[model samples]
Target: MLRLILILFLCGLLASCQYQRPEDARVQIQEIEGQARFTIDGQVHEIKGLAGHTHLQEAHSIGANTIRTYDTTGLQSILDSAHHFGLKVVAGIWLPKSHVPWLYKNEEQRVKLSKELAVLGRKYRDHPALLSWCLGNELIFYDLMDFDFSSTYNRLLDSLRSGDPEHPVGTAFANYGHKAILNFALKIRSLDYLIINTFGRLPKLSEDMNDLDFLWSKPFLIGEFGENGPWETEWTKWGAPLEPSSSQKAEITGRRFKELPREHPNFLGALFFNWGWRHEQTDTWFNVFSKDGERSALYYALAKQYGDSPVPEIPKIKNLKIDHGTNANDFWFESNQWHEAQLEIPESLNQDSLEIRWSIRTEDWFFLKADSPPPLPDLIEYASDRQKIRFKTPGKAGPFRLYVSIHDRSGHFAAANLPFYVVQ
Candidate 1:
């Protein structure tokens, strides 16, 4: 009896020491009842997420269940923080774009990257907060047509799969055009799902997906969507894209979220374009938050759509005009000439608690090149009278934009910019 008891105790100890994968840690896509749905372990999950890594706690508070990153930098910390906030992470694994042909051609380099990715897959595969692995973000599809590039990409995907079979792997493409669809259909069969980043084209995304169903019918996520990107909007005669006011952006964001095809059989839900601060075109073009961590009108819009209880009221900015004219498309000013601009806000907002600031920045024209963001233009000072400002145009003969930022005491902000050309 003593021997039997000792044996039973030993068996229990061994069982306790045995390694077991965490429950509900596996993430994948399944076709249940002819509909593709993302599943955690065996339970279906709809991804209401943000394609950024900051403000995770705030994101969770606003009903965002997932956060997507663009690279693995600080991934462990991001995963930890996300877990702390009960948020899942769609961790991104950055890959060299097709622009770097030499990297793809060098078999040694390609092998090294694959090995590194495999290690990463093994390292974080079991994290409870991990939802999926995104291989790349908006890689140039035109260059991906090269055999070397396509093979390299597929090999990397295979490497990731070898290390983690429990999680799904995918890539993000920009604006799903026919060429992109055809290329993906023929060369990229390894992805568990596809991620498409659409801005102005978001409303028609469902139509495009249906029309190209024969070419590619896999599940997809709207990896990024928001207001029209700078590249997709109307430009001034001198070529500066007209950015919408904060109020307009909020409206657009709400409209786009509502237009998402949540009922589509292959839809896996959408992730808003930006959840944190980004200096893409202007400092405010894509950022939903300010540099000081203040929430913008975009944030309130998302919060309301995300079903935040008691959503905070968004401050309003209306009737922004330059030199008493509402049309910026035909506006041009002499170099160094003073011009007046005005905007009105709701009288309900207390003026004493609001801080209004203004400036002018050179229009960002370097979109095609992957370079450092253009230096912020010199502070063209303005005399402010509440919501009205008088500022002199820049002395240069190029496109410039006047900007206004209004901050309320409650940590909310409103921003607007008007594009104009300065002539010699």
Candidate 2:
């Protein structure tokens, strides 16, 4: 009798200790009536989200169902926070550009990195918030026909798969041509999908995809899309890119969102280029939010598209003009010269409820090599006013941009910048 009781207790203990899979743990792509759709645990799911780590709750509130990251830094916390907010995560794994020869040649380093990635996969595969694994972000394939690099990448993919077969794996590419697509089709057999990061070229994406269907036909995501990139915009006499004002950016956002192939059979979804502040060509280039966490016109534009009801009013900057200049971009300033600037806002907006701030920073002109953001430049101290202001240019001769941020009482703001060259 005693032995039988002990056996029963052990059986009960074993039953309780058995691992149970989390709900919706398996994510994959399925062809339903010739349409490739993403399915989470056999239920079709569409990704509507942005590509940044901050503002998870806001993203959820604005009707975003997913969040995309560029790398695994602080990933465990991000995944947990996302789950808490009922948002899914497309976890990105960082990879070096293909032009780097040493990474492919060094077998030991490759094996180490592969093992680390596999460990990450195994560790997070069961996390309920995980949607899929994006193997890399905007990695350029210099020689798609190179067998050695293909083999190395495949080994990495194999490592990830071995650790977690429940999730799908894909990679992000900068909008590439047919040769790269053909190479992906021929060599990268393990990839479940593709992610293309396009900016100015987004309008023609449908045409581009249709043209390349003969080479590759897998479902793809717009990994990054937003306003026109600095590389594709008009340049000033001093070669500075003319950045659009916040209101203009909102207009562009709406237009680009409309151009997305949401109705296409193979279109998965898109993650807007950025959801948080970033210093790229300019501090405000792709950032939807301000440094102080104020929502900009771009954010409101996206919020409306994502189903935010009763969207708040966006502050407008009719135009920012320098002294005696017809257009903001046509101005040049002398070193340390005081200039009066005029900011035009509609009379409908209550001027008393708005807070205006200004700053001057050196233009980020680096194009090829990636570098850290330059130090913050001096801020312009202005007396309380909304329409006119006086400020001095930098004391040295170089390219600089004057930035203005107007915040309303309702947590909405507008941003605009004007580029000027300082002459001695």
Candidate 3:
């Protein structure tokens, strides 16, 4: 009885010393998963600034349970926080020397380097926050090595497996032609997933994974992607400045329409390329959001799509006809001359929950107001941000302000003021 009492006291002491991280401020991988509705292998945007814990939390909020670090400095904090938040981490050991197929000419040097990576594996292997060990980032840049990477990958996997049997191991292959890609695949052990960097041929991304040509293999991810480098025809890639805004929408939306399906069975996860704004190189242009956070519609599209959504987002609004509410792109109604001047709602937002916000400013720039309470429109779900809103005044013909703001039941809203000329 005395021994039992002492044991209970010891148990209490251990429990008391256990760490408790903030609820909203995430801690480790296991913690955040409790709140996550689905697993998201999201790209981390500003992962460099604060310690890895802070960066990992930001990724968690956006529905990611895993992140691939660009480097190894803040790894421990990231790993710790990720574990608490139910977030997993892909530690990127980018040994640029690894890129050169024969950088380490001597067998002794190669052995030493292999040992270096093994040391890394040994250090973090048992941590609760680990997801996979990405042997190296873009090392196989179609690299011609005297000592093939297959020997090294198999070796590294052996090394990591020695330390941690709990997780899987992988290596990132830089962009490659289908034939070369397939050859590489043949060499390595089938991984939990494959990482392919195919930027120019995105539609082909799905096709590449499908194996319409070669015999099928395990699941894969577009570990790195964007429209073609500036070299590719402007005619071919999505839009302007590589259409950074539109490209994200096109990439993810296309993936959703084409490849996003939990039912697909083999698909596991994906880690998009570098998170921060890296403009030192003119060729790399896949960043979705800017350093300042001026997000494109695609950002919201991903948010709404992953969080919860009733329907796919409609194509972007374009070439609007002001008076008739009609457009080369849409048939929305627009009018003048009293209540009749109101624009008709587009059928796209019809029957869907949405929120749209837009505004019009006269040459003089005073916003109009709606005489009555706003109605929910099919186009926009929620509108906020601009200080100015447009609505129709009590009379349609008074030449009064025509500030119109509409919020549909779906929650989408658009408010804009247009300068006048009565209907033709």
Candidate 4:
């Protein structure tokens, strides 16, 4: 039994020592000098894909200097597109769902994942376009939302610091900064920043931004904030929406303008809830992009806050069909530069192709061979050919989405989205 205990101790030490990062390597927080403002590197973005999803161009057009990607899969393309547009990307990978009922069988798996979590921080610690590393998104739903604010939270933050010393490390709370997140922040105090998400339900939402310092005595960010759901400001409660009037949207949304950085001292910047388009149960609210490629009021509001970069109207497409399946000829790029994507018809053009009217800048997600070497599509001018179809792409803050609306050769029509991410 003594020998077993010793073995376990050794294992623990080995895990802890494996991958460690210094904690001081965090993003520079602009301490208020005189104007009560720190140097603003970039305005943070929420990627806007929460409801449905939006094209990266919309986020870019609104002048987002940074975009938030929730997990590994959600991040790759987001970072890729944001970087292309000279934007920074925030990668938020969860530490394995803590509240996943019946999921890990024992405590050992939890610690093991934590050790691995440290390794993740180290791995991406040096990426140039990486803005921040988020611990988890709305994680505390764990203990009836009371969330044990003690050791568990500390371990997550420590793992992040140990692995990634530079760049702010934090999590986005669905609710305001209360005990759930405070439990972790007050104790660590080292938390580079805190993030808060608020909907219309919260009281004095904008005014509350200033009080963050009073609550934790540390810094904080307005992570997510938007109007009430169904999203139309005029939206009536459940089962009663005939879509609120645009006037209602403009009114309630205008309130956010009051929260803008015209006066706040403690507030850093606000990251709106989403960048893409989404529809929720008869109520379509929050999304800044539309399925037809239209922009939303919030996106414009943001443009005014920062600088505006209007998106060129996306052209339409015809006769485009993407072969649906998870692992088809998938090719991936993980660099931090502007990139264009143009995939070609595989000799296996067995998949549909060629079109009419015009093709919007999106393409089918072809899963390419893992070993298909260079002439690789890393540059703005590089080209690749296969099958009969050809794809040409440019590097920019893409994470660009394309819709292939096909008008049948015989005169029929259909459309689909091609999804891809560029990693920086």
Give me the runs in candidate 4 sitting further than 4 Å from their true place.
1-26, 34-54, 95-105, 141-149, 185-189, 201-203, 206-215, 230-251, 308-424
| lDDT for each residue of candidate 2 in 1-424, tens digit (9 for 90 to 100) | 8985675455334323422233454887777776777788898877787989898988987888888998999999999999999988989998887666677778997899889878988999899999988997766665644656766787888788778877888898877456566556666655788888889888788788788787567788888999888999898888889888888898899999898887778888899978988777877788888777888888778778887656666688888877846364567878888887778878888888888877677777874334324534543546667567777887889888777778888888888888888899
- Alpha carbon lDDT at 83, candidate 3: 86
- Rank by TM-score, highest first: 1, 2, 4, 3
> Stretches of candidate 1 above 4 Å error?
1-25, 143-145, 367-384
**Each candidate: what lDDT?**
0.79, 0.79, 0.43, 0.47
Which scores higher on TM-score, 2 or 4?
A: 2
Alpha carbon deviation, residue 119, candidate 3 (Å): 2.3
Error of 4 at 187 (Å): 5.0
lDDT of 3 by residue, 1-424 (tens): 8985675455334323422322332222221322212122332221111112234444555565556665677788878878887766767666554445453344665677767766776788678676666666665334422235555655666665555544555556655355445444544444444556555665555555566335435444445553454345242111212223242334555464344323333435444433433432121233334333333334344444344433334323322234355221221223432222334344554423444444322222111222222332332222242222233323222221233434444323333233332223
Model 4 Cα lDDT, one tens digit per residue, 174-282 = 6564545444433333556666666664446445444554545434556666666433233112222223322234345557646544344445566666565444422
Tens-place lDDT per residue, model 1, 329-408, is 77788888877888778878778788888777777777533332443454344444668777777777887777788898
lDDT of 1 at 321: 86
